[model samples]
Target: MGVPFEDFKFNRQILNAIADAGYTEATPIQQKAIPPILNGQDVMGIAQTGTGKTAAYVLPLIMKLKYAQGENPRALIVSPTRELAMQIEENIKTFAKYTDLRVVVLYGGLGPKTQIEQVNRGVDIIVTTPGRFMDIYLAGHIVTKTLQVLVLDEADKMMDMGFMPQINRILEVVPVKRQNLLFSATMSDKVHSLSANFLEFPTVIEVTPQATPAQTVNQHLYFVPNVKTKINLLKKLLDAEDDVKKLIIFCKTRTSAEDVYKFLLRKYGENGVKVLHANKGQNTRINSINAFKADEVKILVATDVAARGIDVSDVSHVINFDVPVVIEDYVHRIGRTGRAYQSGEAITFCTPAEEYYLDKIQKLIKQTIPVSDIPADVFVEATGFDERQEQAREIDLQKRKENPDFKGAFHEKKTLTQRKKFDAAKAKKTGQQTDKRNKSPKAYRKKR
Candidate 1:
């Protein structure tokens, strides 16, 4: 009942496409961003994932470039990852369905022969990753002169992935007169610099505060003792909630992701669970995401690589199997659930060491996560000695990062247990063996 899609000044072709996509209402981002975009203003949109941010810019881009014109692309969208590039391509196709516009997606991890062929045929809009786009452009396959509009989606993620050099190179090639749109869920210092350099007194649109989780998401935290107890808590929570029809459990590493996937596979059967990580083949990752989106898979175990771009509906919950070492990734991981104005749950499991990161995440998001009591029925496994030592070491490192003056716990303990100075000068002068601790202080002082 907010602003409807028809209220926007879209053409019949776009209107029909929107209707066919079953999108009746305009999300907050769409409502605020579309008009400025349609006016051809350089806009910087700040919105969270699943707030219909992709379509917010895509719709206006399609409206501006109504039909196919030449062999080269008129507009370009540079995404941080291949998954996001593919998602943007799908959105463009969905909205530009009625028009004769030709759009193609280019990404690495596969041969570019097909993409090069698509461009040769005729492409009005190109959606691609920064690295692959640069690769094709350097090879003389892309025409920068034809690009009238350029969008950098998930600019923060791109910055995190170290795509700034390529982005700068792209800026150098593209015409400066063209419209520039940059969108991101969070605004880091790097993003601010990019905006200052890239945008030309542009209008800034922020639907939500930077790094804030969506209002639709209810978050919970649990302090788990060890990896074994974390798994137990995960099982207990899943077994208790029948409403968790679809969920994603995010781990920090590929090994942990695989282990969680295997555990879920045993519990839910092969067809019910899938795993996605960088190590998985591109086709396998695509299929896994597609299945999850289609509701064919009830669970997806993934690393942070899958966190930024994969958008699935009705995700009942997102479980953080491990707290991300990168503080910014915390926002992206939980952003997976509670998408598209749907209410969802995000639960995080933190070990003693991970609490350091958890504190940083809370400060970034500007909110304290509610801690939930572990279920009485679940067994809380005791931490092994080695694991305990590792956790202590990690926590010490984290503390040192915060305050360089902080000598870590181990440093302090070592200082206490360190052997007293051997007093080599005294040994040389007195001709006494001072290195041995077994020699009594009285004997050493009494003389050789």
Candidate 2:
């Protein structure tokens, strides 16, 4: 029955809470991880975004903490991003609804006083980002010695942002003998080494291969010319396709995310688009995310910072308006859709200069995306390839000249040896033309 809740040996209250949350079946990762976590064993879970990994740790931790019963927070969950941390805190509250357990989320970009007050209230569970958590802990506002369970959510992303040292500091303060659970969408050597340092004799659960997009996701790659052309192409694709019910447009930076959001808003009206990023205040970010989730907004443009821990299902399509700089990020960006076993589409617009990054993405995924050609009518004719190549070469030469360390060996005025080589090639071509002209008269006489 899809990994029954009863099989995990949860208390009746926890079982009732799960049923109340409208979840009877455990997800794949949850089915595998909940058992070990309930048994008080450390876990190393490898699963993609939107795979219910939150529940994999949250449910067990709730049951264990509730049963053991303490006022001070014994469980600590650290996420790489604020959105994810809030989502985890919300999920913990949802699962532990019937219990007296208190859950609070700690993140940056918000006032710390409220978070400090929550900690003072003696929360049983704490979900937070490492940076904000460390800030509070080091400021002597919160205590960590009571922490019994430690969770590093999105561990790979933590490493990506250079938060490993902060994570190490937090780990050092937590109670030495505790259950450690590390979860990441994709595991690398650095992530492995970090896991080695934290989790001891842990259970490893990898439902999907590392960095692999879901099979249900249809991926498309379009080779476009530039940013303006990409916008036009996206407009065309959106207008041409009838089934694009809801969309999440991912941008590479906050500026680009806002730009795309404004563009879409202007074209499609204010109701059509919303933007989410780190720069926004907590209330604003949460409101934007909720609006997108409730279908109040048809298109939500977001930076990679807000991409994780956004668990909205039925997202019909995800458009990479800008190709992600990190290949693994492409996996996470497109992963926003095609979740909950539903078919979804992910399209990436790759400029010529960005093709190298796209190629690396293909190599990592081990499957070449079918290149989509522009429709003949929509194709805007530009300069010839040779002319464009020549222009690019001239631009490179100009840049090198501007550099202080320009080497004379390459771009210096024609040296004697270089001139000799050029003249020799020109002379050979002239002699061939002369011979052809001579043979033309002979051939004409023979024809007569």
Candidate 3:
């Protein structure tokens, strides 16, 4: 049998909170990372999403903090995205419900006045994105000297979003002697470098291989020819009677997300669908997420920004409307489902152009996604000229990337055309010079 929470020896308050949250057994990450964290050691946890890594650290921190302290925050958790920061704050609130510890969340894309006021009122724990945290720090509204614990959640994502400079600044400003915790799904070189700079003799805990998807997620891929065909396939899948209570369709760009959202909206009406992307306002994004979480919307079409930190449990299906260009994001995207040991499905639609990215994603995850034929009910449309050209160009680019000396068909044709023009121009110039030199005496005299 799995180890129970009681074996961890948490205080009564924490144990009660855990029970209230409906958790009895500890996940592997929680069982392993909690002890070292509670022991006041710096920790570097390498685990993918849906592994209860958040609680692994949050529980220990709550147990250590116990109750309210001075006006300044004693612990700070920096997340890569606003959604993630908010999610962490919510988790902290749930686990710290019995205690008097005050928690505040800070992120960008909204007014800072309210956040600044919350900080002014004093908080025990601050969960924020690196940029917003730095903004408040620079504004002199925060006191980092009193910080006892610093956690960088999703450290790899922070590096990917180009927040390393802000992270470095925050690290420099915070007290040098403090308990530091770094967590990430993948251990890229940048994450490694950041860990070396931030963590001091950390107890490295890796519960699973880097970039690996959750075992509960059954992954499938479809080789679609074009966008319309993909849409047709999506329609067929959604129309089926399988368990699709909650679904998230991930698109690579806002335009694609909007397109998918429109299609779904027309079919299912606004009540059944919502869209989220960077183009949407902060309130709209938050509302979309809230609606999805509350089960008011059956489908959410989103970009990669929503892939990393969304924590809606029992997400029945995750569909890749567009293959993520960033291969590492594949793990996080599918992680939205199959949470808390529940079985879920992840379906990817791969156009010819997207196959390159798919290959990279498969390599990163260290497993081949099982390929399946398009459903017989789905109508496969003919590929359009523009789409075909785009796929060809993408394939050519991939070839060039692999072999620098390789010249694609388009490039070779263009080069041949340019050479013909150059040869014609040179021949014309040479003929003109010869004509001038071989001019008749009368013509030459007349010219002189």
All candidates: CA RMSD (Å)? 4.0, 11.0, 4.2
Tell me the TM-score of each prediction against the true structure: 0.91, 0.85, 0.92
Q: Mark the 10 consecutive residues where model 2 has the least summed lDDT.
A: 438-447
TM-score of 2: 0.85
Among these predictions, the greatest TM-score belongs to 3
| Model 1 residue 274 distance off true place after TM-score fit, in angstroms | 0.7
Give the clashing pairs for model 2. Answer: none
lDDT value for candidate 3?
0.92
What is the TM-score ranking, best to worst?
3, 1, 2
Q: Cα deviation in Å at residue 419, candidate 1? A: 9.5
In model 1, the runs with Cα more than 4 Å from the true position are 412-448
lDDT tens digits, residue span 1-448, model 2: 5888888878888899889877878889999998899898999999999789999898888878874345577889999988888888888878888888888889998889989988887788889899999899888877777888999999999999899889999988899989999999988998999988998999999999888988889999888876777777888888888898789999889988888888888888877788898788888889988988889888889999867878987899999998887788988988899887889999999776567678778988888987788766565546467745654554456456558565544354457669757755676565522235543312112335
Across 367-420, the per-residue lDDT of candidate 1 in tens digits comes to 999999999999999999999999999988988888999898799668655544
For model 1, the local distance difference test gives 0.90
What are the lDDT figures for the candidates, one per model? Answer: 0.90, 0.84, 0.92
Model 2 regions lying over 4 Å from their true place: 67-71, 379-448
- Model 1 lDDT, residue 416, Cα: 54
